[model samples]
Target: MSFLQLLIIAIVQGVTEFLPISSSGHLILIPKLMDFPDQGPLIDVAVHVGTLAAIVSYFWRDVWGLARGGFASVGIGTAPAERRLFWYIMAGTVPAVLVGLFLKTGGYLEGFRSTTLVAINLIVYGVLLGIADRFGAQRKSFEELTLKDAVIVGLAQALALIPGTSRSGVTMTAARFLGYSRFESARFSFLLSIPAIAGAGLLAVLDLADASARMQSDAITAGALTFVAAILTMVFLMNFLKRASMMVFVVYRVAMGVALLLFFA
Candidate 1:
């Protein structure tokens, strides 16, 4: 692919990966809309790794806590708060991984990339997110999250396997419905993303081992660009949601879905 293709792909992947907007949806539609060539296996691996790096970097303290907490939780009879959070993240990650594996094995994941399907999900899930945000209790913090909350959110995340059903968006929506504040919902969503993104990237990396030298070089360049973009976007989004409602994202999704229906469908 060309430099422009790499740049656009990197920006889209990095930004949308953390945002409530579906990264998969954008990755699917952007290329079709721009008539860009397919982003091969190497670039796919690069983008996933880059975004993964950004999230891990931004949340290093939490990541470290999760790591330590994981060890503690495994050995101890009952986990402390840190260890509990660690297990919660792990628990929250399971449903998505299982669903992803099933979809990949069935060859159904790629087939869901249709513009019409994405458009419907964008609109429907956008409204669902809005309803959850508006009516949700919004009283709880991350510390208040329970095992039930984490599992329910994980189950909601499984739905995100469908195109336009953003992993972050669905998880946050579920959290909101369970009474978590916007910032807390976002915090858990980002933290939960660690395993989910890493798992997906690891699978892609196995496929990328056979890439050409040129493709590998391009992947490195794209990875660097995506890493920078992901960091900036993650920082901005986390802080933005602290005070703002999720209506902005909801409106954007609906508008984009309508546009896709009009033009692409």
Candidate 2:
């Protein structure tokens, strides 16, 4: 990929990864629309690693707590709230990991990357998110999350394996429907993503074990660039949700989906 292509991938992935928009959908569309060479799974892994790092950095406190809690659950210490949350996250991650492994090994994942499929999902799931945000109660906080809530959101996240379903979007939509506030919803979604992204990246790395040096260099560069963009995006988004609704993202998703449908038609 050229510098411009790399930059565009970084910006798009970084900006859309945490938002209620689908980064994978945009990444898939860009190469098809612009006739750019596919950056391949290596670059995909690189950008994912970058965003993973960003979320981890931004939520280091939560990560640390989760770590301690994880240990505690195994009888190392006692952190009731943290231990509960740690287990909840583990339980939540199960559905997606199982589904992803099935799709990957079955060679069925790539078939869902069609632009029409992406467009439909973008519109449908976006509207679902809008409805959840508009009508769902918002009285719950992060600490109030239940095991049922985490499992439900995790199942919803499994749907994001399809292009344009938007992992963050679906998880947040689920959280909202469960009556959590936007900030708390987004926080849980972001935290849930740590394991998801890491799992995906590990799979991709297995494919790149024999990649060329130049490809490795490009991956490193893309990762660094995406890390910068992703962290900034994470900061902006967390703060923005504190005082705003997600209607703007809903509108954008609908408009973009409509445009893609028309263009593809």
Candidate 3:
């Protein structure tokens, strides 16, 4: 891929990573449509690493609070709110990790390369998010989010490994389904992504470690660009999603899905 191609992919990575669209699905489809060979490890890692950085930077305060709470939980200094939140995040993260492992290790999500499946998943999940948001009880806040609820939300996040199933989409959908207000749902979804995305990025890094020698290739350049794009994308979405309707994302996913089907097939 040329610098331009990498830049384009980076933009896709950034925008989709947080906007309730499927970054992986777009990455796959873009290459297929352009007849580019399978994207390389460098690009994937770069964009994700960038995203990781973005998330950490954006939520440093929350992350710090969580970390402090975690440490305090073992001592006598922790506030009840901090202790509760720390445990809740851990509770939520477990199901997400387990689900991700089951799907990845069990071959349930091996269809990431299939554009048709991705397109279908995108439209279906997008619709689900919209519907869930519309009908959600919208009564809960992050403070009120329960461990039981967190685990279920995490389970929903696990499904995001499938291309077209946005991690944020599913998490927020689950939150809304369980009665979170839009802001609360969106906030928790982003919070939930911190651990899941971190784990995924770490896994990707480990996988890429075996290929670091090729980091000088064009693909690496593409990956760096993608990373920059991913960072900016996360920043924009986290800010914009404060009041954005889930329907807006749904339309984009459906349109993109149709486009993928028409053009890639």
Top-lDDT structure, candidate number: 2
Which numbered prediction scores highest in TM-score against the true structure? 2
Off by over 4 Å in 2: none
TM-scores, in order shown? 0.94, 0.97, 0.87
**Which whole-number lDDT from 0 to 100 does residue 184 have in model 1?**
86
Per residue, candidate 2 scores C-alpha lDDT tens digits across 157-231 of 899999899999999999999999999999999999889899988876776677888887788888889999999
Q: Scored by Cα lDDT, where does model 3 land?
A: 0.76
If the candidates were sorted by their TM-score against the true structure, best first, what order would they fall in?
A: 2, 1, 3
Give me the runs in candidate 3 sitting further than 4 Å from their true place.
Answer: 40-42, 106-110, 216-227
- Candidate 3 residue-wise lDDT, 88-153, digit = tens: 888888877887777768766545679888989888998898899778886788878788988889
| RMSD to true structure for each model, in Å | 1.8, 1.1, 2.6
Worst lDDT window (10 residues) for model 3?
Answer: 214-223
Q: Estimate the TM-score for candidate 2.
A: 0.97
Q: Give the per-residue lDDT of model 1 (tens digit) for 118-183.
A: 999999999999999999987999877688888899899889888798878998999999999998
